[model samples]
Target: MTIDDHKSHLVTLGKFLKQFQVTGSKKDEEIPGNDRFFEDFDQKIDNAIHYNGWFTRENIIFALQQWSEALTPQNLKWWLGDYNLNQSGGKTVGIVMAGNIPLVGFHDFISVLVSNHKVLVKQSSHDKQLLPVIAAYLMNLDSRYENRIEFTKGKLEDFDAVIATGSDNTARYFEYYFKGKPSIIRKNRNSVAIITGNETKEELAKLGEDIFRYYGLGCRNVSKLYIPKDYNFDNFFQAIYEWNPIINREKYANNYDYNKAVYLMSEFKLLDNGFLMLKEDKNFGSPIATLFYEIYSDETELEKNLEEHSEKIQCVVKLHPGKKEVKFGHTQKPQLWDYADNIDTIDFLSIL
Candidate 1:
């Protein structure tokens, strides 16, 4: 595939998604009245949409917009050019998808598509539906990509470059297993929000979506919070409260029970919000739902502290203005122009 091929594939995918939303299912509702394919997902679609404590459309929109806009070769080339590279020839890439979030593996999909390469995608069981929908749309738009993108459920050792996203433990396996291969082995990460004295209720609510969405299973989910000394927890709690009605009560209660069992009796120092838990001392790209945070005093120190946790901190959410940080809540969404892991992914791929 070529850069032009990349554009063709994405535009097709977007249109198909729109169609799926319209006719697919009511629960799968797309951008109001534009498409109808959502009628297909049936009730499962409803649950996916209304499934509390996971992802919200705002963040997904944030991600999808970037994904959609980055479809063109100009955007792809512009992104690659920043790192002084451009797509040259085709390649075969093995991508192991992480099903933590709805479409977490899509980034690798973009990388593979834009770099004039063939993607050997190993779909996750948790998200079997999405990739097919995406592939269907892309294929509908251009037949050329119908065979280029495939769903594989196997291990690969032949690809030129490899990208794998999984838990810290799984990453260890990937590293030792895939050793000597040019790879990007992403470990677990969690998003955290730094409360810098300027957040409003609206922003806080959005942050709630970032935290609770996908049952806090997503790598981009915020598992920690950093606040100034003696900060009012009430304001933060109140904002999160607006989402209380939607919180998966059973899941919340389960996590609450687990934490209380460990903390109240076991003498664990777990910071909790009655729905979530917080604990310190870890190094992974993610944290579990029952536990989510570490308290910090000055954010500047935490910011510096973040360098140490770089391998595991996915996105951080902050309502503090003028901050271009990789803080909490910003995990799922990324600008095409942004270089992840301090390296230009597209740029690097283009050179290969």
Candidate 2:
């Protein structure tokens, strides 16, 4: 099919989103996954075995807007230079996804799709329910595409190009298993933020979602806060406390207990209100909803160290110093225009 042929299909999917009520109303169900997406948005997002848990209607709105901004026609043209269906390209690919986070695998999934390649996917059992629901709607837009993508249970060995996401440990398995194919192997990663003294209450609340939502089980969640030695914990703690209603959980007990134990072992020097955990550590990442802090006397010195780990950092959470978004959240809660891996993902998709 020609670019002209596929362009309308994309538009149709966006329209079907509203027709079917998939993602959200901010953009209308016309887009794609608008209502169901929002249904999942307001529904309980925590599926312990599946990190894809934790998203709100607002989160979906933010993400949808960002995606729309980044996928403009001119930008798509500039990004996807030559890959065309008319040229009868290579066999394209398949993706064995990760359930560690919500649609974390969509980047490569769409990349292969936009490249006009056949994507045979082995959906994580946890996500078996989501992508399929989305596909059912997409199929409504174009039956031609319905058969083009699939959800299966199998090994990644059958594909020409494969991308797999898993823990850092599973990377060795992915490397040896898919060694001969055109592939990208992604492993575990976590995001962090720099908490300047000037953040607003709104920013603090959003940051709380970034850190505590999904119980800190995703790579994009801010696991650590960069602060000056003189920083006071009141505003941060107060903001979190305001939303204390979010902590009513059977699963949160494990993290609460563990963090409490760690604190108790340290002589309870750290007083937590049973919401977020705080401790001293050099690492920007932490386990669960716990946050690690490295109180630096000098912000300049702290930033230099962070630069060394730039590859590990996802979002800065704030602009200069005064007022901006204030804080950041997990990658699960991205704005539509936000780039993934700090790279213009849509542009990258165009080139592939």
Candidate 2: tens digits of C-alpha lDDT, residues 1-352: 4565555555454343333223433435345555455455333333322443444334333433434444455545554555444543345476778765445566566566665667788887655544655555556556767767877786644567676777778889989988877666666666767777887776676677777655666677778877876888888898777657556655666667776887688784564667767777776667665678877677678667767877677655553432322335434545434444555533433434
Model 1 lDDT tens row, 96-205: 88765666778778777766677788876665555665665565556767766777767775678788878779999989988887788877556666777567776777
What candidate 1 gets wrong by more than 4 Å, as runs, is 19-87, 269-273, 278-297, 321-323, 326-331, 338-343
**TM-score of every model?**
0.78, 0.76
Top lDDT prediction, candidate number: 1
Instruction: Give lDDT: candidate 1, residue 28.
Output: 26
- Residue 336 accuracy (lDDT) in model 1: 67
lDDT at position 147, candidate 2: 60
User: For this target, which candidate reaches the highest TM-score against the unseen true structure?
Assistant: 1
Residue 73 C-alpha lDDT in model 2: 58
> Please, what is the whole-model Cα lDDT of each candidate in the order they appear?
0.61, 0.60
* Shift in Å, residue 283, candidate 2: 1.9
